[model samples]
Target: MTMPTSLCPYRMQVHHIKQETPDVWTLSLFCHDAWPYEAGQHALVSIRNSADTLRAYTISSTPGVSPFITLTVRRINGGAGSQWLTREVKRGDYLWLSAPQGDFTCAAHPAGRYLLLAAGCGVTPIMSMRRWLAKYSPMTDVEVIYCTRSPQDVIFADEWRAFPVTLFAEEGAAQGFIPGRITREHLACIPHLKDRTVMACGPAPWMEFVEEQVKSLGVTRFWKEKFFTPSAAPATSGLKISTLQPVREFYAPVGATLLEAMESNKVAVNAACRAGVCGCCKTKVASGDYTVSSTATLTEQEIADGYVLACSCHPKSDLVLA
Candidate 1:
């Protein structure tokens, strides 16, 4: 596969950090040069201490509002990358980051009305879209549905409250908030549900639930960004991969994702949104058998062209990659 040489990594300094929730923090990064990015896109970030551990995070700040880029991250208990950013990283520290990438943006497909659904830290990208609409498309009709464990867990609560928002909480319902998980009945009541474009972002199970509910409502235009990967069955065999760019070969462990395998063997493959929602890890299979997960961000034509998302694919047999 031919990689874009212009998408090289750049360095940014951490200007500030703000703790939003107990487990979530937002980092403001100052770039030496102008950072061009659209709302709802993500950046691939790598810490200086953990050179090989790269992670993708959505850009939370609007394009024209600030000189710096912001990323809101939720620290998972044992996640090395998240833990490092929330606990160890400090202001003045520098990190390597790739240019913004991903197709989960409203600019790609404009709609008359929009329904934005988000849960937990998944609100980051949606927040970007919201800010953009508030600034550039002020007259657009938009509604937001946000879910969290409790009132305290809501990220950007103040900003979100400025718009038309419906909150769902698992505990302690507050004013303008509902209790429990979003149900089909809840979605069924939305006026003109079928006419509005739905954009959802959240954990895998939450996204799946929302997708089914929206489809049941006869909504035709739906776009989603899932932050977590769905559970996959165990792999029965190992795989051998040949990579291009910096030509190299490696052995992938059974059940390991192609991207994970490549990373384990020290083969650098530019990847963002490791959950497979982004096409950054796309590669052409020169000669190989592979089973790509259903969550892969690939079109039918791309699949026919022998392209696969390394983050969501497992090798079915020894493979040779372009």
Candidate 2:
């Protein structure tokens, strides 16, 4: 069997489906052969409906714990990818998945103690780390704060009972869950917060707020796996975006993401997360001036080499991309 690469997707059959909540499901997909990935990585899952639509979903199953990959999907009302995966996909159905990608794992960024902050479905990656730590480094101090809309909406409710994890809900009367949202007080309440490395995931805005609160509490090491924040519609500044290897050009607006314009113009490129988090869309800018929302998974050398996340990058001047 061949191993999957970042750009080459592999087919995996849905082996099992367990409903975690009314709107959320845990899907176990057969790897056939072991899939190589770290706990905090995500895969680009492609589903076929009217046409093929792909979306990034964090792999919730820890590699050392399960031979198969599991994706916990929350059914979004109008989200095509989530809706299809949660409602349409069935056992035995095969889904195309990109290789596990991202660097938001303890293996990549280790700490003596850790603070995990997850909101809603963002719990996927964060909890996967907890599972990984339990298997590989049980003595490591780990604190968890998971926020949900309500207690009933919490995914992985059964498994959490065995661990020391705090659950917060905006509403819903639950015996153990804290009422209302995660506040600065809750973050400050973590003992020796200064020494823990914080890993958080959720909507981009929510992450920013959590990061702010985390920093305010004297914590310096903060890691986040990002969710895409869609840019506002562009007003057509007519900037030229040129790509090589067949060498094509397209016109885009100032605020338009490079990935969006490329796809619209039929210029092929590998991309996932459409957010800066995945780094799947990182490309070398032979010549260009642009602004990127975040350099989440990139290294200093890659940045110096002019590598930019096409998903978050907005061209400022006429651009030539490799």
Candidate 3:
């Protein structure tokens, strides 16, 4: 296995896809040349429909293999990316891609003992890390603590279960399976787990809980990858709200936030985070248009409902929203 020396973010075609679990599937991609990325970094997947809408997916390949990438998509109810990857994307299908980008990687620390914790399908990114570590740093101590609803829900079950893994299943019977969440009490079962460099990826609350618990034990080296829709802006502090009169147009400057654009032009709207993370800044897109930096997991129903995250939205054309 060879580590990628450069960030190769090239468009790739889906060469093969396999259903590994009921809810999870693996996608193998091939490019004209090898695409390279640090383990845990994600690439933006641009899925062009006939109407030309786009979506993004995280890269799940190990950096050790520069040209090939593999991803495990866990089907989520009504999730656009998850559904598309599982039901629509087939071998020989094509998708455009942005260069590999993201800070969630293991390149910063190579020699430390890694405590990788993943819950649900959040295992995708960490799996990349594990794949690389297994090949490049086999001597490094690595322990993966995975929590899933059941054995059936465990993404990459065979691979991880075959490694130095601690399987924590919330339900169903599996020998040595720890029932319940990855709480402080459960972590105690793993001797010396607190002393390792923890890398956690999961739902926001799960990551937060792990960070809090790990910090409580005086372990400070903790890395977390939190997934959340962009949040709404706070009501107080540098925020002004105004409603648009019926049948009026508004203009906002370039780089102005949807909230800022609305507020600057006296268009009343809600906001949060200003960055794409929390889902609080959502609003209906009534008879107008705006540009969103990233979709940030806006539901298909929400897109139909005209809901846009105001904090990360920028006006491209004059639009009306309430």
Better of 1 and 2 by lDDT: 2
Name the candidate, 2 or 3, with the larger TM-score value. 2
How well does candidate 2 score on lDDT at residue 183? 91
* Candidate 1 lDDT (Cα, 0 to 1): 0.80
Model 3 lDDT per residue over 160-224, tens place = 75577887888894887887777887665556676788888887568878888877876668987
Selected candidate, larger lDDT, 1 vs 3 = 1
Candidate 2: lDDT of 54? Answer: 62
TM-score, per-candidate, Cα-based = 0.76, 0.76, 0.68
The number of the candidate with the highest lDDT is 2
Give the backbone clash total of model 2.
0
Residues 1-322, candidate 1: write the lDDT tens digits: 1222223367778999999988899999988876799999888777443445567888899899655799899987656678889999999988777788788888986987889999988999888998888888999888888899998999987787677888999999888789988999988888788998999999856998999889988999999987743223323346777777667677776656787776556564666567676567787788888888744678888889888888888988888887
- Output the lDDT of residue 107, model 1: 94
Question: Where does the lowest 10-residue lDDT sum fall in candidate 2?
Answer: 228-237
